[model samples]
Target chain A: MYNILLFAKRELRVFVDTPVGYVVLAVFPATMAALFFLAGSFFAESEATLRNFFTWMPIAMALLVPALTMRMWSEEIREGTEELLLTWPIRLRELVLGKFLGALSLLFLTLLATAMIPMTVAYLGDVDGGVVLAGYCGTFLLGAVCASLGLLLSSLTRNQIVAWLSSAAILIALNLLGLAATARSIPPSLAHALETLDLGLHFYSMSRGVIDAADLLFFLGLTLFFLVCNGLVLERRLRR
Target chain B: MMSPDSSVLAVKVQGLKKSYGSIAALQGVDFEAPVGAVTAFLGPNGAGKTTAIRILTGSLLPDAGSVHLFGADALRSGQDLKKRVGYLPENNPLWPEMTVEETLAFAWSAQGRVGHKMSAVERVVVSVGLEPVFRRRIQECSKGFRQRVGLAQALIHDPELVILDEPTNGLDPLQVIQIRELVRELGRQKTVLLTTHVLPEVEALADRVVLLHEGKKVVEGTLAEVTSVKAGQQQFKVTVNGSEEDLKSMLATAGVTRLESGFPSSSAQASAVVLADGGQEIFEAAVKHDLVLLELAPRSGTLESLFYGLTQAEGLHV
Candidate 1:
């Protein structure tokens, strides 16, 4: 537990010191607001809620979370510091969990940066605070999922560009699976299973202010799955 | 097989084997470093020196072997055993963005030690002479100072065993001497295992030598033991003002097998390696032929010659 916090603290410091962290923080909220107000047709809808922001948040996170997590393991491998880190008296799980938490904390801050979006909606109309809170909750959970998947792909390679591209590609595919167009192309049975597996679909369920246990379980389970796979990849490297 | 007294051995490995695809990195290699000694792991590139060090440091897993450190099963002992061993891997990898102070503090905290953090960092900082750059970020430091930071992190927790792989690999001459001096100082209190291909490094810092060749340990002993010549044979580098035939005849009479001989130069000075005692007979023959013996020095075996001989005999392109 102590080692995990130590690694997490160091990782957070790295993120804060590097330009990538600021880039993600700036771009995520700006893009979220642009997509919500411009492409989302906020005036046309005349909605009293951040429904459009929630709608675009998953897709935006799919792109930006990879950028946040790409260098988590890839840079260590590239710099050859992985040897120094692993040889320390820390467990593999602690390292992975700590890095995951660090990236997630940054994602949380990115989410918090968009607080004005919710405030603007409330000032303009009677925005339901419960639904707004649920939407943020869902987005945070979805970002956690993306963070873990990005971290896993990062561990598979030493090149940050490769890690970013591969993770972005997979996360985008998972998001697309939740779309109606993708569902129409597949058979009903296959579409049902893919929809259940779709990460965006789980977030959508939570964004509706339901907070269903099934959706929460899906996000937590998938995150754990990716993290475990990351651990296995590191273990394989040790043996190899 | 276990040693008779395992407690005295800081590190012990038996039948350690590791292969990447079809290429074997380590093959049934066994060696030990006694407590409070500097053991030099000498091998050419691709000779599995780094691979063996990685295994000992718990950075890699062996296919089939046991690693015992300070009488404990290191392979399974986990953090408790790891805390006792400090490793500075090859190339001295470190976070360039971190200040020297943060690097030491991180390393100390990573060991799970509570309290005394400031004192621990102070001790290692003083020991490795890192005070000047203690607040400087690693990226701004020179290679020598970066190497000192690497050493400082390894020693932050006051580990019982310090394993340094190529500690002075890319340093300038002065830096090499300074690092060697620090390593020698560390040897006064801790068990030090250093790996290098440089012969003088072994002579300068190591108390014992372990030579690995082609994934196998070819020799292991004290410095003198590993470099000792066999009985009844002696090597001499003799430069004499004599003809080739005179040198050859003199060597034949002296009962010396010529390992190598050089051609006579402008001054008719030729040198030859003769397997005899001090070339006393060759000296007599030189006198008989009126050949001015410019030099006759007994050539002692060196780690370089032994390393090359062993590697070359195995058809390796050393």
Candidate 2:
């Protein structure tokens, strides 16, 4: 626990000390906000509510979260700092969890900055505060899952670009898995299996002011699975 | 068998082995490093010196061996054991993102040590001789200071045993001497496991030495114990200002069983004299003949020669 907190503090310090964090924090909110306004004005039929704003996030995160997390472990290995960290009296799980939580905190802070859009929606028309709260919960969980996936992929390679591209590819596939329902000939069982893994379909259920136990379990389970895998990979490298 | 008082063995390795697929990095290597002593682990490149240090310090696990640190099983609970061991890898991986003070504090706390406040960090910084640049970001620090920061982190926990791999690799001669002195000072109260190929370093600092070759322990003991002179294989160098032919004939008749010479024609002061056996008899005869000997001394074999001699003699390149 102390190890995790120590490392997490260091990770946060690193984020604040460099321009990379500021760039990610600014780019995600700016790009997502711009896309939301453009789609609302030119393409959508009605004013953009928190639903429309939340709908654009997973797509935005597919690119942004990978950029944020690609350097978590990969850069450490590339710079040989991983050896230093490994030699310290730190358990593998604690080290991984520390960095995971640190990255999650940064993402959450960036997500918090976008609360103005939902607050703006509340002023314009009748908006269910429960749905808005659920949307934030679902979005945060989705970001958590994405960040863990990104961190796990980042652990496998030292090349940050490779980490980014591979994580983005995985996120894209998982996000679009439910959309394969367009193939009319596809069987229901196979489609259902794909939908269960599809992050987009789960968020759709959350956006409708409904939070299913399965949806929450899916995100939590995926995050835990990837984090465990990340820890295992790090343990193997340290042993080697 | 070992004792707690007289034999403060900081490290004890037996049947240590590690392999990466088909390549065995360490093979049945065993050694003992005593407490409050500087033990140099000498080896050529790829000779598993770093691998052994990593295993002892809990960074790498051995495939088939047992390592005990101060009599505690190193493998069974490495994290618990690591608190007692400070390791400096070949590359000093100082965190560039943090200042020297911040980095050292983070490392000190990581070892589960409390009271490593500003005073503690400042003490290590001053001890390693880095007080001038404690506020600088590590990325901005010079290589020597970076190395010092690495050393400072290792020393912050004040571990019982400190293992340093190639600690003087990048330093200039002056910095190397300073680090050597610091290490010697530290070794007075703590066990130090230093690795290097430099012969004089081991001779100057190490109380005991282990020479490794091809991932095996070739020889390990006090400096004199490994390089002691024997009757048949004694070695000496004699410098004489005489005719090359006369020098060779004189050495041969003086009971110098084997002699090899490489003298330059321009300088009579230059002459090569190698005697394989009967060093004292050859010296006495050469002196009696009134040979204008420039210099004569035993060719003190160093850790470098010992490493090359043992490794090459064993037909192992590394």
Candidate 3:
């Protein structure tokens, strides 16, 4: 626990020191807000809620979260700092968890920046408070899942661009999970599994103020799955 | 394997084997470093010096073998033994965006000793003479200062065993001298294992030498013991105006060993030769004879020749 925070603190500092971190943190919400107000026609919609922002975040995070997490391990490995970190007395899990939490913390702040859109909706007219809070919860869960995916892919390569592209490809496939669920060619059983496995399905279910245990379990389990995979890859490098 | 209570041998590895695909990085390499001694790990470029250092420092795993550090199982102990180990890897990995103070503090946290942070960092800073660039970012500092930072971080925890790989690779002569001084000081109190191609560095700092070739140790012993054959028999080259017989007769009465008069060195013809207990006595003999001495150089009796001879025999010459 202590080692995790030790690494997490360093990861946070990396964001502050580098322009990439600042650009990702600010641009993520700015682009989301722009898509919400400009492209989606915020005032023209006949609803007093931030449904547009919540709807756009899944697709936005598919690319944006990868951008944020691409540098997590790729830069460390490329620059040889990975050797220093690995040889430190801390366990490998603590280092991975610390960096993951550090990246998620930035995502938390970016999500918080978009709260003004819902706050504006509430000011204009009646808005569902439970739904707004649940949407924020759902966003955090999605970011956690995507961030872990980015981290796992980042460990597989020394190049940040490769990490970014590979993670973006997988994330794009995940974002399109709903389409696979309704496709006819994948067979009824596989299509059913696809719907059950869909990230968007769980996130959307939570966004509607449901907060089901199954949805939370799916996100938590998937995040843990990817974190374990990342840990395995790092350990394998040391061994083989 | 060393018993847990034994401190005579600081590190021991046996039958270590590692391979990447079909290329073996280490094969049946055995090594040991005695406690409280400065040991030099010498090898050619493709040798397993760095590979061995990586395993000892807990950064790399060997395919088959065991490593015991200060009598602790390095393979299975996880981070416990590593707490007593400090490693400065090749290239001196550091955070360029971080200030020297920040890097030191992070190392303190890494050792799981968060209390007395300021004193610990300040102690290392002073030890490395890093007071001038305490707040400077790593990228802005020169390579020598960056090396000082690397050394400082490695020593911040005061580990029992310190391992440095190519610590003075890209430094000026003055910087090398400074690092050599610091390393010599470190050897007085701590057990140090360093790898270098610089033969004089071994002569100046190492108490013991371990020379590896083609992933195997070809020579390991005391500095004098290891270089005994190459530089053991004392012989000096002499260049004087006197004839060979005249020079030989003048030094015949001196307490000298067998003297040979020939061109033993490649770049010069033989003026004279003195097989003596020490090279300085040649000057005294020349002065006593009123002979005009031109050049008096010792034969290649140093680590450089020993390194070349050993590696060349193994076909691993650098």
Between candidates 1 and 3, the one scoring higher on lDDT is: 1
Candidate 2: residue B173 lDDT (0-100)? 94
* Position A68, candidate 3: lDDT: 80
Better of 1 and 2 by DockQ: 1
Candidate 1 chain B weakest lDDT stretch, 10 residues: B309-318
Ranking of predictions according to lDDT: 1, 3, 2
Model 1 CA lDDT for position A177: 77
**Model 3 C-alpha lDDT per residue in residues A1-240, reported as the tens digit of each score:** 899888888888888788877776677767876888789977897788777778887777788888888988998898888888878898999988998998898788777777777877788899999998999899899999999999999999989999999998898788787787787678888887888878888888777888999999999999999999999998997986
lDDT of model 1 at residue B239? Answer: 75
Clashing pairs in 2: none
Among these predictions, the greatest TM-score belongs to 1
Docking class of 2: medium
**Per-residue alpha-carbon lDDT of model 2 for B1-318, expressed as tens digits?**
111233767789999999878999999999998777788999888999999988887777889999988898988874878888888889888778789999888888888887737788988988889988989999899888888898899999888888999988979998889888888778777878899987778888887788888899988887776665422355566677777665665565575533334446334644543535546666676777667766677775545555555666433211
Question: iRMS for model 2?
Answer: 1.5
Segments in model 2 whose C-alpha atoms lie over 4 Å from true places: A41-48, A181-185, B1-6, B229-300, B314-318
DockQ of each: 0.83, 0.63, 0.58
What is the Cα-based lDDT of residue B167 in candidate 3?
A: 91
Show the colliding residue pairs in model 3: B231-B301
